[model samples]
Target: MFLAAMARPRYNSAGECTFDGKIGVWPYVEWVAAQKESKNRKRGTMELKPSTSVGKEKSREYLIKYVLPAIKEKWPEEDRWNTIFIQQDNAKTHVDVDDPYVLREARRGGWDIRMIFQPPNSPDTNGLDLGWFNSIQAMFQRKMPKDLPDIVKKVEESLEEYPHQRLNRIFLSHQACMREIIKHKGSIHYALPHLKKQSLEATGDLAIRLDIDLEYVEAARVFLATP
Candidate 1:
């Protein structure tokens, strides 16, 4: 999912916006035919492509062609001074971080872009997986797409309408989940901490950044050093 459908949220209480920045969604599927004709469309005619196995090569191309350019284009120009990290779940099809082509492309146009994998088996580490995807999935499910194209259209609609503030909160939750991981030595048994961000925001008390306590940082470091 990209930012094109909606604007990226501002961290402050004002809920101000930078721009109606959009990173358009890139569906990887090519049109394919329905085995049998359906009410939606004729058989063998153009339709949304189903997931046709994203191999490493395709992932690389996606990063190069779609993801990176979107970031460079949609990302706020003022915030381009630092590295941009695009996180992916630990999937086999994801390109290696150090892949030469990826590294080269990431450094293109003077941007310090990079890719990183979410912690294995830790869905909490992925903002989308933590909540956004589930929320969209629920909405998409309600659409009850009869065919793959319908599914794509419905899902795209779901994503486009998805609130940017909610997306930001999910990312905040993901950070809190990481803090929980540090406190628990990477254990998944920790409960999600409730921030009541909306209330905090109402009072202008919401923190834009979640600071990992010193002990929590030390704990994570020690745990990593032990192995």
Candidate 2:
């Protein structure tokens, strides 16, 4: 499987899109020399094999060695020092926010990167689940990759071909979902909210951030305060 990371598309002071928000995608695989000749390759040919173990150590290594560098490299130069939060689901294999190696690498180049877990059992709150994974998967399915390497290549191509506007819409939907969760007293039973994002963008009326109603905020506060 591949691990992907992204952020909301960002614009510069001139309103020009500086970042398309595709941080990077990496596969959990390593090269190994074939012990014997196979139908696909000669003996001693190096082949990509998926990692046998994917636990905290592996996750930490990926974050420290790959994800962090990608984020720093692709993030806007002006915001390099900003506190960037990497949201992930609660998985046993995921690295802790306070992982020492992660902390050490994240703070390099004066960047402040942190990790946070999405709400438990709330897949809609994840931007990947909201749309990204599906978008890339749909595109790659049409490619009909012949092998592991081809699959990785096709997946990366799909990510490159994905429309930035659609990704922005996904992030908006993610924010809207969070608002719904808050408005419903932390319940995840609400229907998905539709913003007609494409139409709005066509009319040049797309909002960068969705606003939460004050009444909903107060209601949520009251709910939390109740004995």
Candidate 3:
């Protein structure tokens, strides 16, 4: 999305926030603004944190604080029986799974929180890269954000408005893609399979977890062992 450091929300022609208006500014952790605001928010506002760059340092802050907490709260209880692996793209900005702060905080609640890096060159396996961005882009384009706060607010709203069922289907698609990649010896050159997920979901026949074929797993393991 909008990762620029500064954006001006529309104001009167004179450009003053005469109405106590909003501006689009990305402050770092409010890091320099530290200890001033609660962990939930920065020092002075009620909105969610301002939209910032998905940089390495920032990703660490968010993973430990924001994303982890949200997952803990909403994750299904049955799913908590084992370690929770939060897989993200291997972006340089994302923190390593063993970063001391990540390790320390991750263990605090007796939660086995961990990060997973996807295999490189396998964009087909990422649900976000596949279709979710299209959904987000469409939603974002529909909104006319006037300022930074409005922009952030609108983006958050769009995320909320995105269909959860669509996301579930994306996960299933990801699994399918992974299986395909394995069959191709990890090559990412195949077309993504269309599962008619929506139709299956509507008919109460869609499966949340797709079974991985043993051959694909064996194939992947064999390929990995070679190098």
Candidate 4:
């Protein structure tokens, strides 16, 4: 199944002892989708970091033109008919009230997509969102950006500096967690806590369980039959 995750990039400025900052930086939204493996294996992530600041119009265009197409390309031919599991946070840009254009277009596109929202204030449930941002923050922590352009440049530089092996490891870690969830019969709480802890430990034990027994008989049957 295609498991997707989304997050927003916030811009904050430093302030002096008794002074207020004047510049207000705009927010940027990012989305990533990956194929989940049996033993919590994950493929490379296809991500979208939009230039347009967070808004309905910008979000709509980016999703329709970029994110949707990238996700569509990743689905297997047989699984193309299956609904894409889009794990979305409670972001205003994602479920905007002002414009329903993106929703309408998404429905029209041949993407069988559904939003899987996490509980409010629950970042731990979404691992990739935490993983990617943490890597970026670690890379850029030594310097402060003066403006949006500077921020973007630093982000790009960090992305380049990041090793492919690190990303592959992240994807694999997420895949392992998803497998645990499936094994535990869609129980996010059961899988996430352990996965989070194991990720910090960096042990390859995450891939140990190849088959998780599904609570639903039909699900187990389908999973077994899928080859």
TM-score of each: 0.77, 0.87, 0.67, 0.49
Query: Considering TM-score, which of the candidate structures 2 and 3 is the better prediction for this target?
Result: 2
TM-score of 2: 0.87
Query: Which consecutive 10 residues in model 2 have the weakest lDDT in total?
Result: 218-227
Reference-based lDDT, each prediction: 0.60, 0.72, 0.51, 0.43
Tell me the TM-score of model 3: 0.67
What does candidate 4's lDDT look like per residue over 8-122, in tens digits?
Answer: 1111233111211011112354555545544443565554444435544655555566555654553345445665554555665564422366556555656655544554564
Q: Write the per-residue lDDT of candidate 3 for residues 14-49, one digit (tens) a residue.
A: 423222111112223232344467766677554444
- The lDDT-based order of candidates, best leading, equals 2, 1, 3, 4
Q: Distance from true position, residue 186, model 2, in Å?
A: 1.4
Error of 1 at 159 (Å): 1.9
Clashing pairs in 2: none
lDDT of 1 at 179: 77
Q: Give stretches of model 4 more than 4 Å off.
A: 1-53, 74-78, 96-100, 145-147, 157-210, 213-227
User: Which one wins by TM-score: 1 or 3?
Assistant: 1
Error of 2 at 88 (Å): 1.2
**Which has the greatest lDDT?**
2
**Candidate 2 wrong stretches, greater than 4 Å:** 13-15, 209-227
Q: How many collisions between residues are there in candidate 3?
A: 3
Q: List the residue pairs that clash in candidate 3.
A: 9-147, 24-148, 56-93
Name the Cα RMSD for model 2: 6.8
